[model samples]
Target: MTPRGVLGADELNNIAVFKAVSPSVVNITALGLERDFFSLNVQQVPQGTGTGFVWDTQGHVVTNFHVIQGASGARVTLADQSSYKAELVGAFPDRDIAVLKIPAPVAKFKPVTVGTSRDLQVGQKVYAIGNPFGLDQTLTTGIVSALNREIESVTHRTIKGAIQTDAAINPGNSGGPLLDSAGRLIGVNTAIYSPSGASAGIGFAIPVDEVNRIVPRLIRDGRMVRPSLGVTGGGPEINRALGLPKGVALVRVQRNGPAAKAGLKAFSRGDGGILAGDVITAVDGEPVETQDDMLTALERLQPGDSCTLSVWRSGATRKLTVTLAESDD
Candidate 1:
């Protein structure tokens, strides 16, 4: 039996989620300077207003990199209306994530309940807690509109496995938490596929799984550690200009590196004019068409792992087993 003059169970659950997660969400303001166009004067400007959340009790806050980019300073406002000066710790523009530290008491911070995004289903109810258009602590409800969507980062790299939602993400909603029905953090709202710069029911978030893998590394190393192949290759433009086939040709191989140890040669000028060196065609039996593909394939492995590479040399194909080394460059 339903209670008289009371809300339904779904409505009650939504309200409870907003109350539980709003405390963890924060409003960020970035200050900068801009020169006036008409007069030769500089003025202080509010460059950005975005959202973030408490990652832990040690005063670390996580937000999008573009939120604080180019700002001279920033401030964080909490749910209790307490504001504090925030210091930029580190930023990963390739993943669109940044971390900030505030000198606030432990008692004032409430870390959000972290959740996994590995098994999220489409149409599951989700809520976005952000400060859209500078309206602090606003709550919007929607569903997981899609999954495994790819979005481009500020660094021009493709961020795979992005979560697409219809959760009314607006300008000030960047870096805010996208919570599940149970109020657990699943994704960080990053971009929207809207032409009008408003909520067109199409928004994207960085999956918490990638965030889980990268944030700790950022907190410790202050940068992302991506695996490399120890060889310098050219992009597609250079490949086309050289009239080479669709593959990453080694232009330079590091001395005593993995490729050098495996007898991989680099392009050189010899008696027979330009000597074409080894052009990498595949890795671990998977076809690599361009330099980006090679890098993406190498990212799946770590240092000290052995893999077989297929190379095209001297009008023939050859295989070489190379031991991966930690990249210093």
Candidate 2:
């Protein structure tokens, strides 16, 4: 049984699922303008291309932040060759998801079924349908190599949890759906762990649970709302490098900050004897792999939303619920 390509049994099976969802996947093109001078010249421009799925019949298409960034005009093209101009409905840059609206006929927009990220097990069957390099509605299959994986944020200031897969995701694949075996959308393809700018068997996606939680808020507001503790960490990476568990050692506090107001204590060099600090290993049961993980979790909560912190102190882990205060930023 010689074949022209190295197609495996799993890949063949996944092709069926991909075929079923391909029509629902769309290629997103963001158009904008760059003026030549002060109130002078203007020309229509194309920003970038990313993949997205038909979120609903009302024309909500979900995508990534870096994709439609600075977009003045946008368009979504379906597999059936139908095209529609898109309007930026909403965006949450923190979660890296954007919702675009297209005025297409109701029949053309077929929404994909959403799945839970909490249910994904490592090595489970997963597939990706994307517009890789403008190749329109292409599919690649692989297993979920890991869950709750973190990828560097667009700002390089934080990291976001993504569903890691071995699926062949490429440059233009950002914002495409990462599907489970039952053809359900578990994640949105966001980035890759490749250095060669190609699919190196490591692709990442924004978890559907995160998406499900943030999209509604972004739709209501123009941005994702996050609660703040208003305490700065005391250069904790040095301690972290010396074989200690990682997290900020609370050094300074704002008198009116949520952390201070909630009675969350800190450690000072003069008063140090293994002082009690909230050694944050996780937030809301999601593991904090890095500082970015904490930031991403923080991005989901709003001021006045009470939250419980998983803290470690003196070799024991305890939960401390802290009432959130608004971030001045």
Candidate 3:
């Protein structure tokens, strides 16, 4: 074979990026408990494998919650092939993000450089390093195919503002880091649009902006403490049956809660029939047509923060300022 000439600028950049970022990527092995039918003995067995990256020198590792879902425990294998038993720190399954901690020394870690996803273009270059099919440390390159895509989480909640790429994300690639050309983490590879359970050149990643927002809270509280309005609303079907406006129709409002204190009335059954209630059409000028939209908007604010809600009632609309409260959900 003829000797290859000096590499091009792009090739050199790819090489540099792979070398710089590969060390931050790690392989995750999920372990589950299984009972032997004959002896009835419970044993820890390998459930699955995925990818993750170092979040900090304190041994915090971030990965998809689904990657370790239902597993009894997990193990993290660093770039040096050193494995350590990991402890679950926290998880926000609504966004498919989880944090694990390893007891490895601080000197053994190299956290990936974090980048923002708010300004990603549709055609910017992106790179993915993951353990596809359990083969660790594989690198694939592609571009941002789309932006602002949405995907469902394990909790059946909508994860908005996802980043779509053609970066060859395979099954084992879940929870891996999706980096930009500068070797900065832009997203965390989560899912793919494939029928055969392989890379179909259509992959989705949780945007790093969301990750950066949720990870810290998870680390601090062990879960995402979403802000709530203390009002139970009807779903789309119920809203449609009631002929309500394009917003959440309050079905029940907790007494003395934020919504109730704000004078938001709930639907009631009168002598004639079901009476109309206040339907929230917007939050602080942001239109919310569904419950998920309302939740998404509220997630942007903190508990105790005051916001204006556009409430629609019989033939009239009014704005109500209500204080948000922390939710257990």
Query: Model 3 RMSD to the real structure?
Result: 1.7
Candidates 1 and 3 compared by lDDT, better number = 3
lDDT per residue for candidate 1 within 53-72, as digits (tens), equals: 99999998999998998898
The worst-scoring run of ten residues by lDDT in candidate 3 lies at 131-140
lDDT by residue (23-102, candidate 2, tens digit) is: 88999888888887877799767778889888888878888888888778888888787778887877867667888888
Model 1 stretches astray by more than 4 angstroms: 1-4, 34-45, 133-135, 236-247, 266-289, 293-329
Model 3 TM-score relative to the real fold: 0.95
Report the number of the highest-lDDT candidate: 3
lDDT to native, each model: 0.87, 0.78, 0.93
Clashing pairs in 3: none
